[model samples]
Target chain A: MKKIKQIFYLGIKGSNSFLAASLSAGNKVKLSGLASFEEIFRSVEKESSAAGILPLENSLSGSIYEIYDLLTDSKTFITAETEVRINHALMQKERTGLQKIRYCLSHPEVFRQCRRFFSDNPSIETVPVADTASAAKMLKELGPDTACVANPAAAAVNNLRIKKEHLEDNRNNYSRFITVGRKLKQHGNKISLMFNLKHVPGSLYKALSPYARLGLNLTKIESRPIPGRLWEYLFYVDFELNNGKHGFDEIITAMKMLTKNLKVLGRYDKYDKIKNS
Target chain B: MKKIKQIFYLGIKGSNSFLAASLSAGNKVKLSGLASFEEIFRSVEKESSAAGILPLENSLSGSIYEIYDLLTDSKTFITAETEVRINHALMQKERTGLQKIRYCLSHPEVFRQCRRFFSDNPSIETVPVADTASAAKMLKELGPDTACVANPAAAAVNNLRIKKEHLEDNRNNYSRFITVGRKLKQHGNKISLMFNLKHVPGSLYKALSPYARLGLNLTKIESRPIPGRLWEYLFYVDFELNNGKHGFDEIITAMKMLTKNLKVLGRYDKYDKIKNS
Candidate 1:
């Protein structure tokens, strides 16, 4: 078995994923870029020490249910959680002014996010690429009259000069990322779990009664639809353990008896704890 | 103010939205295609009789939270509910064999969904267009060698011939759509409401106890994060009142006093009920 000090993320270098991976792994582990989300999980699953960083949800866009579905299917377990503030910056090969650029290259989603910038500067023609990272890499390749919108990390990685900062329409946009490892972390202040309730009236309430009775703080709760089953849903819940893992085992034992197909996704501290530490 | 017998949707003719709008509005109303979701809501807000159809959730992709946010901000309410079985078909200007096709035009999402089809036939190059509807519109312009992936409706609308059906990798994929109108739907069995709690312990359980007490069946329950509020979330719950509008007024009065910012999004029947009737 091959083991390396590497963390995998989706997309090329200098993306929001790259930034989050860099932060989550810190300077100890090397960051590796993969083509797809599934590939990242595959790499981590193969090597136990390696980790995969996936953007699970965005403040504005909501949760990435595909990743949740992937997490359910994969043998990996969540170990850590982090947040990356999305800041899209416009850059070019040369230090050209906004008026000098004729073509602006970016992902279609990025273009939509920075809609106001283009509407204000109607002279710039928008070109959609596969991703923001590629857009930055293609800045010089496209020509001197072109600019690309990407993360500031991309500006450093691709050696492009920043023309504008915070180009997104909403400044409050943030993506919550999770680091998935082969083994679960047994210690943390918060725990994430998912379960399926039996098809009976008040089953949902009965399942939730444990948390309310034990005074467990449910930070997030959402029900996701099961594909072939039509209206039947899988519930994903996250709660904070106030007493610092006091009843972690007991809670798990209690929940296992109450719910069906109960899966403990992870145990981790909130983003604030990591930020403060 | 001018009002026409038109029901608006997001994309052009022959798209999934168009199919949903058609099923929702029936043959009496002319299905109109709009450029954006916001525009459709705006049009309906101006004219009370007019309605807009929006895709709310996909069995595979999950809920479109942006639409939920829009619903929270807008005056419109969900008047009806319908489901559209997503069927992507390969078509072209002429009835050409799969071997004759050189390029396939479709929305990037459609191309991703039909990844298996392209992988099986490596000779065909995928061209990512704006949408499936426009892909069909551009088929004749792109020539006989070029094929497009879209709904079967596009084949009839654009005067093209379908070469293959069920091109998507997952045949069971479905999108649930909701018709939003100016006034509340007064007589449907299921009711959708969203509320924010006062940040107290057991507030969620307390809010849910009402349902358990009455044995109300909760079809769907989801938590949507409020942007800029960090961890706070607004709960969206859909419950079926089996007694046929019995205690409807009393429950509204009871919940009004129990919850904060409680907004009754709509009253609508299940898709199965509509499909059968």
Candidate 2:
């Protein structure tokens, strides 16, 4: 067996991150949880046997800004990616009728997802908790009337009774999870690059010119704000290599001239850059 | 005065959104609250005399993703921008010591800001609420032991007493707010443009080149993900016009060839894009 491959994720077990990590890890893998995303990245960069699964973006919620910030700050690379279908259910201490539950407890994102459910039951008061796991604990402590929106794992772990299943407004809700590693794995054709551009005029346009000149197809382009520096943004771009090989070197050389600092984040095959898009 | 200039904001009275709107609006402005961000956008676009102030980016938290998504989906343009200093305090029903508080309640963002306070007092169990305004309302209902992280306005409006002030770790926390309207107000040197490019290689690079040749400085470049169409992104850029006057016509003509669809979002001055950044 491969000496127990180590995998890290945000939050403890029964979390969405944990669920994704479990689904993505190989045989004999030891899954562990980190308190913060920063810890996960730190461990992944230090240990070659380790990898981390982080929620990059949710289909409904857009991108997780903190994850991108941590990724840029670390020496890690995106090795793989996966999607976790977010399934939120209303759980309580016992089988209570919808009318009996006065308060609903869950994360704010969970509340956003169950917008329709809350709207339909105007009498039910919605209270945002930290996360699903915490919501479960709070349900036990905060009295019987406080219901929680949870995933299957959270409900099972906490031994809470499910009052209703499929509470989320949309059935197709998903969060795109990306696996990070210390070593750049040559597992796919898509390459990710991040760079800081000069504040001068035409710098951004000049920086992107090389990729356009080489006829490279960009799969993604994202910009994250720097904390203290408000005007300048760090650009992250993911593009499929020219025919899965040539023209990468040329593009890098061209980027070096335009950008103050640039880092090749990773190169991997994107499982499905989304089917319809 | 000035026909009671209408300004729309997110959330009801005694909320952070309301606070930002109040600070950003001009004299004789009649501010109104909207139930949802979508409603604010719809009202702003349909009414010629109306404008809505939406939170764009926070210095510490980064971009507000939902606002960006809504901005792209609507015909409204960003007409003005401003920054509001975020101040959070510890409030409760009584002037009880921190030791008396068993449960700390507030928005998750508020909790994040008071990380130091929480770590120092590990016994305080944090319960995240919808927002500061709701947290204040909950303090009246959820018992006196629950202390809330709140703004001064929320405390005053909800009749909650302040226990501790300046609970936020960073004194430099500020949120960038933008006023959106139907008309593209051309009051500043900066111009905002958004475009959806074809999936073909080099399309984005080609689209940005005209500005580079003309030496127009790009102040901002943000990309928002399109739901269902996961891979495709809408690029929003703010570039300073060449010498604050020329080359805009030439760049627009070139962009027409490369982009599938393009919208000129607006042109207005950014009130201090952040001094240090």
Per-model TM against the reference = 0.92, 0.85
Model 2 Cα shift for residue A147 (angstroms): 3.9
Local accuracy of candidate 2 as per-residue lDDT tens digits, A174-237? 7788888887765577787888865776677667777777778777776655556655777878
TM-score of chain A of each: 0.94, 0.82
Give the worst 10-residue stretch by lDDT in candidate 1 chain B. Answer: B268-277
Off by over 4 Å in 1: A1-4, A273-277, B1-4, B273-277
lDDT tens per residue, model 1, B97-159: 889999988877787778788989999998766578888998978778899999988888899
State residue A105's C-alpha deviation in candidate 2, in Å: 2.0
Q: Candidate 2 at A182: error in angstroms?
A: 2.6
Instruction: Give the count of colliding residue pairs in each prediction.
Output: 0, 3
**The candidate that achieves the highest TM-score relative to the unseen native structure:** 1
lDDT of 2 by residue, B15-132 (tens): 7778777777777889898877788999987888888989877655556666766787798888877777777888888888789899987888678768788989998998787777
